[model samples]
Target: MSSVTTPRYADVAVGDALPSLDLPPVTRAMLAVYCGASGDHNPVHVDLDFARASGLDDVIAHGMLVMAWTGRVLTGWVPQSAIVSFDTRFLAVTRIGDAITARGEVIEKFVDGERRCVRVAVSAVDQHGETKTSGSAIVALA
Candidate 1:
């Protein structure tokens, strides 16, 4: 696993790619922990019976949990304060036991007032290469 390094604004380019983070598999226990911390006790995400009754193969992961993984790709590289904004859309359900990879690429880099910022196209893709979430973020460079 490669740790994200702070990007130097002067050396950054629009096409630069962020180091991808391969997250651990989504286990049932992991979902439970996330549920406890996030206070989202949705049975669809934690109870297999509820999931099956709801027409799913098994319990799914919380969308926000997956989104947070995408955010980790940025936070690992930059200070939290540098993040100006982030938004994501849930594209697909991430079922239990699925391995997800967080990916990002510098789509645009420019000046915002006196601050240098970079806009990145970000996504969380499963082992099957299907994207579960897609998003973008704006991060100010130090």
Candidate 2:
């Protein structure tokens, strides 16, 4: 487990990497629950038969759910109040039983007027090292 603490502006620097977050495998049961909660009950994400008919090998996890796993990594390391913006793009499909892990690196840091901010390049990859999502975020440090 990573140690979580409030970050100070003066202590942060470029090139630092946030600790990686390894999420549980995306199972059928998990997909069913996410489908109901997110109202994204698309057959491609919850029904294997429909997914196969749609040309997918099996039901896939929601893209937003993978993004949320990445979000968990960021929020785990930094307070939500310090976050300015977070965004991502889906790169590849995450199928059932895939274990996604979130990773990030500090790409830049700057002082905007009186506010100190840091930019991070983030990604979510599966156990096989295939990148499923990629994004960047800017956070203001206190």
Candidate 3:
């Protein structure tokens, strides 16, 4: 019998780390643009009165926007055919003027039967060291 070899997500060794991302800065104007682009007009993201009424002191960045930057880092490491899954958690609100960076570390790499795969621990943080989001990805290499 012959085996067809495919690229795997976790092919990287345990110590391998993906190239990180220094995302563009977040600004209030950017938030307005995002709100327009995404169509998530809950007011909490752009309206201060609504945000304060909802218990926050000020408008905050959309969690999904903050989380999605991890994609930039992950896609840089894995081929389009290799990714299997992706997700994240919101840890803290990112504010206008917050400088965010994305990073990932390979936690495990193993063969899923004949398919190679990788698992990464990922996070986004501000310059102040406040973690804005964290997540993981399980990729199946092509």
**TM-score for each candidate, following the candidate numbering:** 0.91, 0.91, 0.85
The ten-residue window of minimal lDDT in model 2 covers 1-10
Which prediction has the highest TM-score against the true structure?
Answer: 1
Mark the 10 consecutive residues where model 1 has the least summed lDDT: 1-10
Clashing pairs in 1: none
lDDT of each: 0.91, 0.88, 0.81
Candidate closer to the true structure by TM-score (higher is better), 1 or 3: 1
Q: What C-alpha lDDT, on a 0 to 100 scale, does residue 97 get in candidate 2?
A: 81
Model 3 per-residue lDDT tens digits across residues 1-142: 3232443443457767788899878887888888998888879889999999999988999887776689767777766456678889998889878899999988877678877777888999999999999998887765
Q: Which candidate do you rate higher for TM-score, 1 or 2?
A: 1
What's the lDDT for residue 57 in model 2?
84
Q: Candidate 2: where is the Cα deviation over 4 Å? A: 1-5
Clashes in model 3: which pairs? 6-142, 7-141, 7-142, 8-116, 8-141, 9-117, 9-118, 9-141, 10-117, 10-118
TM-score of 3: 0.85
Checking candidate 2 for backbone clashes, the offending pairs are none
Candidate 1's displacement at residue 45, Å, is: 0.7
TM-score of model number 2: 0.91
Report the C-alpha lDDT of model 1 over 1-142, residue by residue, as the tens digit. Answer: 5554567898889888887899999999999999999999999998989999999888989999999999988897787778999999999999877999999999998898998999999999999999999999999996
How does residue 8 of candidate 1 score in lDDT?
84
| Candidate number achieving the greatest lDDT relative to the actual structure | 1
